[model samples]
Target chain A: MDIYDILFWVLSAIAVSCALGVILSRNPVNSVMFLILTFFAISGHYILMNAQFLAIVNVIVYAGAIMVLFLFVIMLMNLNADVEPQKGQLVQLAGVISGGVLFLVVLAGIKSARPVTIDKAASDIGLITNLGKVLFTKYVLPFEISSVLFLSAMIGAIVIGKKEDAKPIAPRDEEL
Target chain B: MPVNSTHYLFLSLLLFSIGIMGALMRRNAIIIFMCIELMLNAVNLLLVAFSKIYGDADAQLFVFFIMVVAAAEVAVGLAIIVMMYRKVHSVDINILNRLKH
Candidate 1:
């Protein structure tokens, strides 16, 4: 066993455990924190893959920006208290079944992946800037459309979350 | 002691399924967002692993775009969660089924 082996095991273990914690933790704040740890661990894996740009961006976007937003919303919502664990027995059973099926499908796919030949031309240039070039020259249309979609989604979110009249969104039957 | 890519893939599959379970079963909207992040991270890991094994950089670049989208998602999703909390006083998602009509 070499350093690479040890590093792989340790980081993979941390990522998997923290991801599980994100799902299992009852406190939303705790769950968000676990998610942060998971992101950090994943960034480490990216580093191992020799993708330094992706590593930094992964940490910055997912860990620094997105997770902080999650923390703020969780704190703002006051979900830090001892809210009863959601008794999602029926939904959970169904989730487990589906999750199992999906995992099997993915595992089978992974088992069959062929190592295709790499193009020497692609690796001759550094990807950080090359990707930008591609995005502008080749992928620009999809890029522009996604940004528009994001803008519309942002508008929809603002509209959906706007301050309301007397009624809570939760109907009476499901209200706890 | 070098672990193969299959090891990482199986682990990723487990993490992805866990994320799915959280998204499906969690009543707290915040946790659901985190689970989605988990799933994205799993996919990102797979992309990078494939990028390494194939010696390609395009997937890594694609991951960069994905990170941007995920961040945008969080900004919007957090805003919505805060709004929902203000209106409902709790983030219990089961309470959100009222919109199903």
Candidate 2:
């Protein structure tokens, strides 16, 4: 096996195991930490595929920002393994079985599909310069729209998070 | 054998299944949320792999947009979770079943 194959196996193992840790860990904090590790492994895969921009963005946005937010919330709530709730054992078993069935079904369906050989040689399409050109020229509308979505999401979060006022001022009070 | 598209496909599928299993097994709302993130990452990985296979940047851009949406979703979702915690004083989702009644 070549270096690429070795790296792929190693990274995939790390990712899969860490993802399991995310689910199996009793503490929410541990789950978050495992999820961060899983994100890092996924980012490594992105880099392996030469998608430098996505690798960086995944690390920054997912592992750095989003995970920290999860950690902060978990810490704020003081959740531990003891306090964590779990589904019944039968339900957990069923979940595993159902998920496995899905995996097997999809695998069987795709098994006969044509396998396209990946070009292992370096490609420029994943580079930031090319991606930026495409993003701004062809996808500019969606980019701007995403910014608007972000603004609305920000507003929505604020409105949802803020505490309700103890007293409501009536229209008659405004008239007075 | 060299790393092929099929290998990546299998890897992502495994990850996605694990995510589904986690989402089903966990009763903690935050953990479920995290499982959703895991599933999203699995899809992202597959998308990047496809982008590489086809020599296309569009899939990569789609991954970028997915990331954007995920970030916003986390912000709003966590706020709602925090609000729920404030109201119920627990992150256990079973407690929310009272909403139906």
Candidate 3:
């Protein structure tokens, strides 16, 4: 295998391993860290696919913004090993079995499908310029709708997360 | 040999499977949320790979939209988790069953 193949294997391995770490780690903080590592590896894959814009965005949005949010929640909750509930061994086994079965099915399907050769030349499809053109021209409606979705999410989060107002209980009239 | 779409597809499938396992097995609500994010990222990887293969920007654009939705989801999901923590004093999903009462 050449450098491209080598890199692909390495990045995918990192991603998969880190993903396992995220699930297996007992501490929530560690899980978040592993998730960040997984995101980084995924960003590397995006780079390999020559999707430079997505690579950058993956790092910035996922690792930067979303992970920090996860970390914040974990820290705010002060989660630790003791408080985390343990799942039954049988359930865990079932989860593993199902996941493995799905993976095998997907692998088999991909292996059986006729391989289509795509042009390897550096394509500008992933570039910001081309992406921006399409985003504004073709997908402008969904783009605006997504903004609205974000706005509603922001409002919902704030409304749900705000501390409840503490009202003093009034004394009973009979007691007076 | 040059890397092809199959390789990328395999990698994404692996990641997505891992994510499914995590979501199924993990008890912590936060970790489960992280697993969901992992699944989303796996999907994003597949979309980018397919975009490269198909020589179109549409799939990549979908990736962008997916990222947007993921961010919004995190915001709302984490808020709900936090709210749950305040009431229950834990992030364990098992404890949430009591909420039915």
Query: Number of the top candidate by lDDT?
Result: 2
| Model 1 per-residue lDDT tens digits across residues A1-176 | 66666777899899988988888877777887888899888888877767777888888777887778777776766668867566658878888788888888877887886544322222432346766786688778878877887798678777776667555566658655
| Candidate 2 vs candidate 3, lDDT winner | 2
DockQ of 2: 0.85
A-chain TM-score, model 2: 0.92
Looking at candidate 2 chain B, the ten consecutive residues that score lowest on lDDT are B92-101
Error of 3 at B64 (Å): 0.2
Give the clashing pairs for model 2: none
Arranged by DockQ with the best first, the candidates are: 2, 3, 1
- Please provide, for model 3 over A1-176, each residue's C-alpha lDDT reduced to its tens digit, 9 standing for 90 to 100: 76667888899889989999999998888888999999999899888878999999999999999999998887877775546878999999999999999999889888876665646667777889999999999999999999999999999999999887554667769979
**Using alpha carbons, what is the TM-score of model 1?**
0.82
Give candidate 2 regions above 4 Å deviation: A166-176
Local distance difference test values of all predictions, in order: 0.76, 0.92, 0.88
lDDT comparing candidate 2 with the true structure = 0.92
The two-chain DockQ for each candidate, comma-separated, is: 0.51, 0.85, 0.80
Give per-residue CA lDDT, model 1, range B77-99, as digits (tens). 87777776777677777778896
- Candidates 1 and 3 compared: the better one by TM-score is 3
